[model samples]
Target: MNNIVPIPLSIGNTPIRKCDFLSEYFKTNIFVKDEFHNPGMSSKDRPAYFMIQDAIQRNRIQAGGTFVEASSGNTGLGIALIARQLGYKVKIFVSKSCSQEKIDKLEEAGASIELCDNSNGLQDFQSTQFRAQSFAAKEQNAYFTNQYYNTQNIRAHYRTTGPEIWEQTDGQITHFLCGIGTGGTISGVGRFLKEQAKAIRIWGVEPRGSILQHYLKHRTAPNAVRPFDAIEGIGRNFVPGSFDPQPIDQIFQVEKDVSIDMAQWYYQHTDIRCGFSSAAVLASLKCYSAAMRFHSDDNVLLFFPDHGSRYLSKLYAENSKVSTSNAHSLNG
Candidate 1:
């Protein structure tokens, strides 16, 4: 809806509302920034818009030109959505491990798909990211909007999302919880909030197999790391260039089963239809709630990255046994 930016599509300024059920249990406010309101129905829309607009402004790309990016799912869809709006062509090199629904959505958005080798759902051997970069370089007039390394990714969230949250909470937010993917969301928003008030805690959630948690603890990646393909797009084997570790307070490593179970609970019980990685943040809250300092009046906000609809096949499939009988509970 930006006239000056040449994008007439609706994006950003999503709602921040309290999760009434979760708030009652925690004895404090639990707010979720619903990024589904974006034109692409995901938080990725913010950066996608910014990066594309930036490329256009710099004359690195032109109308009707091909726009390329390597994404797990949502980011590709964001670019694809915007590219179509601006009469640009999109080619996405996505992860082979991503859900079928994501692949279908990308095609629907007019993005040509290239499924790259994501060895066991983690980065390995000329990954999707590198493929996009190489292809963009070789292709005529093609620009690779690399979300992993793009500073515009962080700038998008910092300039818009962070300010929105701060204003929405009236600067009373005590904790900000988010899943660390490319590290842009948490890093950007966390830095902005910290600049405003250093007391505001920024907590990142990482899937069990991700190297980010290990990297944070020891300042180095493990020699051998396990692959976590259960959930798409929330963890990284190698730390991304966009990830600024200085703004992050701490990170919690979560399990795939628990994350999926939490997303399932939201689908069946709550009004919020959270994706796998968003549920990872919720699971982190459940697991680490006791350790955090929670006061009655504190506002704890969650950055819900996307809706659960795109994950129906993976998280809520008939054969998927990720959920236990007591999967819904915050208690162990």
Candidate 2:
């Protein structure tokens, strides 16, 4: 008989494949974890599964209740996937700035949606999250699964993503590259990798508009001190509670066009189509990896956050031109 056992989910434990384009560009063996293959079409599935499962065990939530939260896109999909499977209701609050495709997908999944107005010059998701919190507090049998502050978000990456990378690479991973959104994914994964091996370098990639890169560079920056970036799911207007700066070796600020180009490159180069932030991460990996002279003894790993399906309007617009309107300045 075969020793392979049945797995519960087809999404995670995704392929960590070597990137041909990136490897040629970087002159190093660069690998991308195809997180877009996840059920929710993003890496959020990892944390969302653990978050919901742990919430159930800890009695933080009960069945048939409403799971209320704010999301740029992917996290909402993750929660909706579990909510539908477990017979719960999900209400997602999204900023008006999020892509239209994301809004449609959440609704298609039977998630109730509230669109927040960012026309008043208020920061994007912060306004939405605030509204969501208020709504969750007033609603009956509602639980707010705050992805940003939730400790389970961090734990998810630590237990699953980090160990998986270490195992898949046969402990040869010298550098880990990813974009910081809620801070959960990178923080958890970086912390775990550092604990397993002290020499591992964890580098976080953020959009140029985000403060994370500036924070890493100057330990602080004006305006950017608040997590403000345009890329969905990977940049924050505020620092998440779960993010720890200690384990990070460096930060790279990626331009929107660079990310857009890389995302387009993915579709052209590989069968896999990934989100904007995923492209940003890979582009950053290419740039960073190329600078380093590594032998077969070294390894560089990059994470592809979500699928490109959610970003068709922005990244794969009808015209050949990709929009750069979302790009903001970190120094401002």
Model 1 per-residue lDDT tens digits across residues 1-332: 23336665788889999988889877899999999899888999989998998888888886688999889889999999988788889999887788898899999988999988762222554688878888898998899999988999999999999999999999999999999889999989999999999999999999888888887778787899777535677888787888888888899988887787777666665755678889898788777788876888899999999988888877777633335665546434
Best by TM-score: 1
The best candidate by lDDT is 1
Candidate 2 Cα misplacement greater than 4 A, ranges? 1-11, 118-126, 217-229, 286-297, 319-332
Estimate TM-scores for all models: 0.92, 0.85
lDDT of each: 0.84, 0.75
> How many clashes (backbone N, Cα, C below 3 Å) per candidate?
0, 3
Candidate 1 deviant stretches above 4 angstroms: 1-4, 119-123, 319-324, 327-332
Q: Give the 10-residue window scoring lowest on summed lDDT in candidate 1.
A: 117-126
- Report the lDDT tens digits of candidate 2 across residue range 90-196: 99888788899999989998999888863111244347677777888898877888887789899989998889898999888988888887788888999999998
lDDT of 2 at 16: 91
Clashing pairs in model 1?
none
